[model samples]
Each structure stands twice: as C-alpha cells, then as structure tokens.
Target: MRRLALPLAACLLLAGCAPTVSLTPAPQATAVGCASLIVGIRGIETIGDAQRRQTDAQGTAAWGTPASVTLYCGVETPEASALPCTTQSGVDWLLSESGDERIATTYGRAPGVQLITTRDASVNDALETLSGAVATSTRGTDRRCLADPGASATPSAIP
Candidate 1:
C-alpha cells in the first residue's frame, strides 16, 4: 500500500503540470512545420509560463487570462486574392477582425501563422514580438500589400 501511494502521488503531480491550453492539434501533414515554430519560441514578450495555456495542437500558444492572445503556428496559406494586408516590424500580415478581437497572419507564406489579439492590447507590440519568430520559423515570399500610388505614406517592408 505504501508503494502504491507513492506512485499515485507522482501521477497526480505530473498531471498537475500538464499544459492547460486547449488547442485542437493541426493536421498531421502540417504538424512537422508547426513543431519547428514552437522550437524557435523560447519566450514571448511580457508573457510567462504561468500565463501560457496547454494546447492540443502541434504548434500553438496562448497567453493572458482567458487568453487575450492566441497564436497558431501552422495553418492553410491564405488565397492570392486581394485582401487587406499590413506590414509591420518587417513582417507582412493579412488582417481580419471580428468584434473586439483582431486576427493577423503572415501574408503569402507557407506554414502559415495566425495571431489573435484583443482590441485593448497593443497590436504593434504583439506584431513586433511575434514577427521575428514567424520570420525565423517559416517560409516567406515577395508578395505584399500593394502600395497606393497616390498615398503620401509608403508602406515599409522587411528586407
């Protein structure tokens, strides 16, 4: 009974340390690339382990209470059609918004990335913190948001 008790306690301890993020794993085909993305993310700005959630997905991360920021490492590439693309911190992200949250992803890149952030959060800061990781972990392309010929402010791109 003593030996059984010790083993049971160990099992409980391990379970307690398990990841709490509840992400659905990406498809097996994309898992490998997703795994690569996770390997590069040693840390994210202002986010700690306690804030991270356990995800079932192969390559995904979440932060903040109730997860104000959620990121998926590998997703299907976006279509070539004209979508609102924005470039920041040397990264090109196709933007989409619903309610108070915004979703952005690397435009025209394989092993795609998706970042979700609440409106209250600083999108620029999030982009700055994540762009380097996304650029390092995935493939990139020449495609970008077309510059407005008449607009005075030209968009910036990371070389």
Candidate 2:
C-alpha cells in the first residue's frame, strides 16, 4: 500500500505540472481548407514568451500558461463592416475590442482565422509572427481594406 501511494502521489504531482489550455473550436473548423490552415498555425513554436499549450479542441490553439492568446481557424468570412482593418505581412485583419480582450480576424480570406488576446498582450507582434503562416495557408479574396490606397476606389472617396 505504501509503494502504491507514493507512485500515485507522484503521478498526481506530474499531472498538475502539465500545461493545458481550454479553447472552443471554430464553427466552420471542419471546412475544406481549414485542416491545412491549422497545420500551418500549429507549426508556430511560440508567441512572445508564451509557449504552446495542449488544447482539446480541433482547429484551436492557445498560448501561455493561462492562455494569453488563442486562435480559432475556419470561422465564417466577414462581410464589409465598420470594423477597423489593418494589413499585416500581406494579410488583412479586422480588429475589434471587447473589454479586456483584443480580437483580430482575417479579412478577405475564405475560412477566416480569428485571434483573441488580452488587451495588454503584444498583439501586433503576434500578428506579425503569425502572418507568414496565415498568408501561406489561407485562400485570399478580392476584398481589401477601404483605407488601402491600392483598393479599387478613388482616393478622394475614401473616408
């Protein structure tokens, strides 16, 4: 009994130290192109000082011990909206804020990617680092940020 109790306690201790992150998978995560996109994102080793944590959901990823950042791929592509859009590493992202969280969604890409992070996190740095994979994996569309000069509209007409 003593030998069994010692090993059981050690196992419990090891389990407590294991890193895990809980995240909700995107609704369209099983869409045709999403698997490839997830593969690209999973290739990312780290974000800032946040290392990857094991997540239970498919097409979802979380970084940091307490999950400072999370990504969900294969959400519905967003239509034109008033949301501020910015281009990072050749990918257009629509940005929004909800209290303490900052959200960025890939614009003009089929089977969109959404990123959620704490407001204090280095979102720009994470976007920059993740952009390469997103650009390579996702399918692009004709949609462009209205502020982009190259977008097919007269310069004077842009707000």
State each model's CA lDDT, in order: 0.66, 0.77
Predicted candidate 2 versus true structure: per-residue lDDT over 1-159, tens digit per residue = 999999999988876774677677789888766788778776686898887777878888888768888888888766787776778788888877778887889889977998888854567767887878888878899987887546523211212
RMSD of each: 6.1, 6.3
Best by TM-score: 2
Give the alpha carbon lDDT tens digit for every residue of 1-159 in model 1: 999999999988885764476876544326655667777765653543225555566678877656777888767765674546676656678766678887777776667888877754555556777788777777777666564534312222211
What are the models' TM-scores? 0.70, 0.79
**Model 2 misplaced stretches (Cα beyond 4 Å):** 1-16, 149-159
Please name the candidate that would achieve the greatest lDDT relative to the true structure: 2
lDDT of 2 at 125: 63
How well does candidate 1 match the true structure in TM-score terms?
0.70
